[model samples]
Target: MLFAGIKTDIAVDMEPQLIPLIDSLPSTVPFVGPEALERKRNRAFKARLGANESGFGPAPSVIAAIQSHAGEAWKYADPENFDLKHALAAHLGVAPTNIVVGEGVDTLLGLAVRQYVRESTPVVTSLGAYPTFNFHVAGFGGRLVTVPYGDDREDLEALLAAVKREQAPLVYLSNPDNPMGTWWAAAEIERFIDVLPKDTMLILDEAYGETAPADALPRIDVSRPNVLRMRTFSKAYGLAGMRCGYAVGAEKQILAFDKIRNHFGMNKLTQIAALAALKDQDYLKAVIARIIAGRERMVQIAAKNDLAAIPSATNFVTIDCGRDGSYALAVLNALIDRDVFVRKPMAPGLDRCIRVSVGLDEELDYFEQQLPQALAAVK
Candidate 1:
C-alpha cells in the first residue's frame, strides 16, 4: 500500500451517488394528521370535526370483540386474512377468492399502485381527489393526469377521456368522495364503468358506502377484471383506529395483491373488531341515521350563517363560503382558534369551501356558536 503513496492530484471524491429520481421528487406529506395540528396550536380542540372519522364510535359488540381478542395480541395476524375475507364475501355476496383485505383502503391503494404503476405509468384521477391515492402514485413514479370536478362531483366522462388519451394503466374514483362528499347515482357510475377503456384498471373507492343511499352503490360484480371496489371500516363503521379495509375484484385481480402486500399487517384485534362490527348491522344502521341527522344539522348551521352547504351523501358536508381560498382559509383558522376543528379543500376550483365532519350535538353546537365569528373574522 505504501508503494502507491499518491500525489494530491490522484485523490478522488468519496461521496455516494444519489439516485436521479430522488432529486426529481418533491418533498411532501399527503395529509397532515389532526395530532400534528394539536401539536402546532398547543391546545386541544373542543370539537373534532375535520378528519371524517365517526365520532359516534364503533359498535358496542365490536369493542367487546377487541377486548376479548386482547389476549391474542402476541400472535401475528393470519397472512391470508382468510376468515375476514370469507366474512366480507358473504356480506357482499361475492366469493371469498374475489376479496382481499388489507390494513385499510389507504394501504390497498398503495398495493394497487404497486401492482399497476411504474416509472412514467399513466394514472388518472380528479384534481382534488383523495390525496393519499395521489401520494401513492407519485411515490411509485407514476405520471398523474387529473381532471377537474364537474358540478362538484368527479367528472366521470373527463376521467375516462384522460384514461383513454393517456392510455393510463390505472384510474381512481371515490364515490361519495372525501372533502366534497358528492356522489353520483349507481346507474351513472355503472355507465361510467361501461365507457371506461377495457385495458384500464379502475379503482372504485367506496370508503363511505355505508353512509350512502341504498341505490348509490352499484351491485357487487367481481366478474370484471378491470374494476376493483374498495371499502373501509373507518368511516361509517367507526373503526378508524383499527385500520381495516378490503378490496373486491375479479379473483385473478384480487390475487395480485398477494404478490406484494404486507401479509401480517392486519392486527389480530382489528380483524375481530371488524367482524363484530359487520355482524352488528343494526348498530351500523343507527349510526348512519345519526350521521344523516348530523348532516342536516350542519346544513342548518350553514344556512343560519347565510352560507351554502353542499348536499352530501357521506359523513361530512362541504360549506361554500361565497369567496376565495384565502377567505376560506381564514374562516378555517378562525374556527381552529375558537377550538373547533375543521378542514378545507385547497385546489383552485374547490378551495372556496370548508369541509366539516359529522360530530355529536354538543360539537355541532360549538361549531354553530363559533361559525359566525369565524366568518366575520375572515371578512
Candidate 2:
C-alpha cells in the first residue's frame, strides 16, 4: 500500500517502438490464398476455383523441363534473367532489351510502383480492379485516385480522365479483369492509350491474356515509352506456384525495372519451366479451348438457378447473384462451407457477383451439385 499517488515500484519493461513509417501503415493482408482457406477449414477443398488459376495444369513439356532442372535448384537464378528475357522477347517479336522478367505480375507491379511513385505521388485505377496494385500504391505512400467500374467493366474513358485530372504518374488496368472477367477490345484499349498523358506510365496487366480472344489484346507497341504490358505464366501456363511473369515495354522503360527489382528473384526451375511452356503453343491452345467450354458450363449452372452469368473473355465467369454484397458473401460462405472453394467481389455495385474459375469437369460437377444447396442455405 502506498500513501502517495504512485504505487510501490516493481520491475518495468518498456516495449520497443516500431518504425514510424510502419506504425503509420495499417495492418493488412492483401490476399487470402487457397492454402490459407484449407488451413482455416481444416480440410482440403474438393474443387479449387477461388483463385482464378488454370486447373488444366502446365504443359507436359513444361513439367518435364521443371523436372530436368530440378537438379539445378542448388544454384541461384541468373540475376540478369537473360535467357528468359531473350526467349520472351523473341516470343513477343521484340528485342531482348525490351523485356523484364519478375517473380510474377504482383511482384512486377510492386517494382513498377517503387520505380515511379514517391510519397503522395498520384496513381489511378478502377475502384474494383486488381487490389494488388492498390496495395502496392499504399505500400509506397502513393495517392490512389480510383474510378468506379461502368457496367462491370473498367471505364477506360473515366480512368483516363482521372489520370489527366490528377496528373497521376501511374495508372493500372487489368484486361479481362479479376473478380469480373470483363474486357475491352484492342481498339478501345489502343484509343485509351493514345489519349493518356505522355508522362503518365500505364501498367497494362494481361494476366489472363492466354485465355482471352486475340482481338481482345492490343498489338504490342514497344515504342510507347509510357505503356508497359504485363503477362503472367501463372494463368494459362499453369505456373502460378512457380511465380513467373514478365513485362514488355520500351527499352528504357524495361531497363527502369533493373533499378529497383530483385535481381535474383526468379527461380532457376521457373525459368526453365516457363521457357518450355512458351514453346508448347499446342498445349496452350488446347487449354484455352477447355477453358471456353468450362466457362459455358458455368453459365449453364448459373442459368439453372435463374442467375445471369456476365460475358467473360477470361478463364473465370462472374455470375450475377441478383442481390447485394451481403447475399453474395452469404452464398460464397455457403459454398466454402460445402468444401467447394469460390470467391466474390467485395466492391459495391459489382459485389452482386461471385467469380468462379474454370476447374476440371469433376470439380465443376462438384460445384453444380453444391450450388443449389449453397443457394438454399444463403436464402
Candidate 3:
C-alpha cells in the first residue's frame, strides 16, 4: 500500500541456481552456540559452559607469537603450511609428509567427507557422536548409519559391524566423545582398526585428544592408508579463536587432500600461534592439570545436587540428571533462565544428561550456586 510509482519489491532471486544436493539440504547449524543463546535470552550468561571450549586460555608465548605476526596479516599464509607441519612432525614422531593442515577440525572433516562420501554413500558413526561430522555427511548427500552408544561409550564392535553390513567407506569415532565425555582404551581402538576393511576409511576426530590420557590415543602411524587422525589447537591448546587443525595419515591419503582443500585457509597468525603452542608443552601440561581439577569440582557440584556425574576423559563433564529427556531438558532450561548456560544430550540413550565445559573457578562457582535452584525448579 505504501509503494508509489517508484515501486519496491525487496525479494530478488535470480542467480545460477544452487546445486540440487545443496539446495535440498536443511538449513541448520551443527551447534547453536552460546552466543546465540545469550542473544535469545537478551542477557549474557553468568557462566559460559555450554560449548566445549577451553576457558583456561592459550599460553602467553602463544599469545605473543600471534601478536608478533599481527602485522603480517596482509600476507597470505603459506599454502603448504610448511613450518607448522614440520614442527608437528617432529613433535608427533611422524614425517611432515603425513600432515594436512586446514582451517580447523571442522574444515578438515568436510574435506574428508568430500573425499569419501558421495551421493547415497553410507557413512557410519555413533548415534549422538559429534554432530558436525554428520552435518558434513548430510550436506554431501551421504546416507548416515548410526550405531547406538553402549554403556555410554561408542560401541566400537557395533560400529564395525554396521560398517561391514553397509559397506560404508567413511566411519567416524570421537575419542573421549562429546556430549558424554566417555572414551575407549587405545588397545581396543587398535584392535578395531586392525579389523576394518582396507578400502574403508576411518575419520578419527581427536579434537579432545590433548586433554585425554596418553594411552587413550593410539600411536601415530602414517603407514595406515585408511585412517585419518584429526586434531585441533582449539581444545587443550586454548586456541579456539584461531582456526587451525591438522590431520595425520598415510602420505598418499594426505596428498589427496591437496586436490580439494582451501589452499590459503590457514591464517598466518594462527600458524604462528599453533607453532608456539606446540613448543610450550609445559603450559599444556599445566592446563591439563587445571582441567582435571575443574572436572573434579564439577563432579563434586553434581554429586552435591544429587546427580551422577559421568566419568570424563575430556575437558567437559556430562552430569546424569536421573530422569528422562524431558526432565533433563527442563533442568537445562532452568539453568538458562537462571543465567547459567549448559547443554544436554538429545540422542535416545544419552538424553538423560547435561554437558558442562570446564571454565574458570569463579565461572563454575556461578554454576555451583545456580544449579540447585535450577534442579528444584525443574522438580
Candidate 4:
C-alpha cells in the first residue's frame, strides 16, 4: 500500500482535464501570418503587405538602442516597468500611476477583458472592427453583441445602443479602424464618450492614432474610470516586431492590471527600443509623411484600375472591387496566386473590398503592376 488506504493504481487514460470554459471553446487563430501561407504554398510572397506591419521599420536610434542593450538581455525586464511607465506618463501628460505597459495592445486587451469579463458576461464591439478583441472575449466566455458599421465606419451610436441594451461591461472601438481605414472626427468621439454609460468600460484602441490626422484624436484625459485608451509602437514608430503597447486611464483602473498581468512579460530590448522611439519625434513625423504619400499613391492606383479606394486615415487602404463579395474575393485570391499578398474583410456588409497595407515603394510598385493582371484573371 503506497499510502495506508489510498489506491496506488491510476488509470493511464485519465489526463489532466481543461477547465470547462476552455474545453468548450473552439481552436481559432485571429490572424494568419504571411509566413504560414508561404509555407503552405512552398513559396515566399513577392510582396509582403497583408499583415499591416510597417515595412518602413524602426527608427535608427531605436535600432542603436536595441543593439546597445543586446548584452543586457540576460537580465529580466523590470517587473514594475518603472522607467518606461514614467516616460510614457511624461509624454502623455499623465502620472506614472495612470499607465500600464504590456506586450502589445493585443495582450493588454486580454488583460482588460479578464479584469471585467466572466462566463456569459456581455461585451460589445463593431461587427468586424478587430478580431483579436472578440477572441479575448470568447476565451473568457463573454457573450459578444456586435453593431454593424455605418458607411464602412464603426457605428458609434449603434455600439452605444448595444452597450445599453445588453448592459455590457466592456466595449471596444478602434479609431481609424482596422481592416477598413475610416475614422470619425475627434468631436464625434468626444460626444460618444460624454454619453457612454458611467458603469460600462470602454477600450478605445488607438493603435493607428499616429497615422491619423491631429484633429482625429481627442484630447487625452485620464480622469474618467470608464475609458482606457490604448496606444502602440507598432504603427508609426515602426516597431511591430518589438511588441510594445500601453494603456492610459484613471489610476484605480490602471492598477487593476497588476492583479492579473505577468509582471516580467516585457522584453528588456523592447523596453529600450520603445523608450528610444518615443524620444525621436522628428523621425516619427518624417515616417508619417511617407505613410500619407503612400496612401495617396495607393488611392491613385485603385482609381486607375477602375476600383474605388475608401478614404483612409490609417496605414492601409481598402479598395472596393466594383462588384459583390465573391468578385472581391476572386480579385484577392487572384492577387495572392500571382504572388501579391493582400487581405480582405470577410464580414458580410464589408466583404466587397480588399485591404492593402502601405508597404515600401518597391513593394507597392509590385502590387500596382500585379493588380491589373489579378483583376483580369478575376474577370
lDDT of each: 0.92, 0.91, 0.93, 0.93
Better candidate by lDDT, 2 or 4: 4
Model 4 segments more than 4 A misplaced: 1-8
Per-residue alpha-carbon lDDT of model 3 for 1-379, expressed as tens digits?
5655775665577567899999999899988888898899999999988888888899999989888779999999999999999999999999999999999999999999999999999999999988989999999999999999999999999999999999999999999798799888899889989999989999988899988888999998789999999999999999998989999999999999999999988899999999999999999999999999999999999999999999999999999999999999999999999998889889998999999999999989999999999998888
TM-scores for every predicted model: 0.95, 0.95, 0.95, 0.97
Best by TM-score: 4
Q: Tens-digit lDDT track for model 2 on 1-379?
A: 5587887565467566886655778888777888999999899999999998888999999999888889999999998888888888888899999999999999999999999998899999998888888888988889999999999999999999999899999999989788789999999999999999999999999999988888999999999999999999999889999999899999999998888888878899998998899999999999999999999999999999999999998889999999899999999999999998899888899999899999899999999999999999988
Model 4 over residues 1-379: C-alpha lDDT tens digits?
4589887667878888999999999888998888898898888999987878888888999999999889999999998989999999998899999999999999999999999999999999998889999999999999999999999999999999999999999999999898899999999999999999999999999999999999999898889999999999999899999999999999999999999999989999999999999999999999999999999999999999998999999989999998889999999999989888899998888999999999899999999999999998878
RMSD of each: 3.1, 5.2, 4.4, 1.4
lDDT of 4: 0.93
Candidate 3 similarity to native, TM-score? 0.95
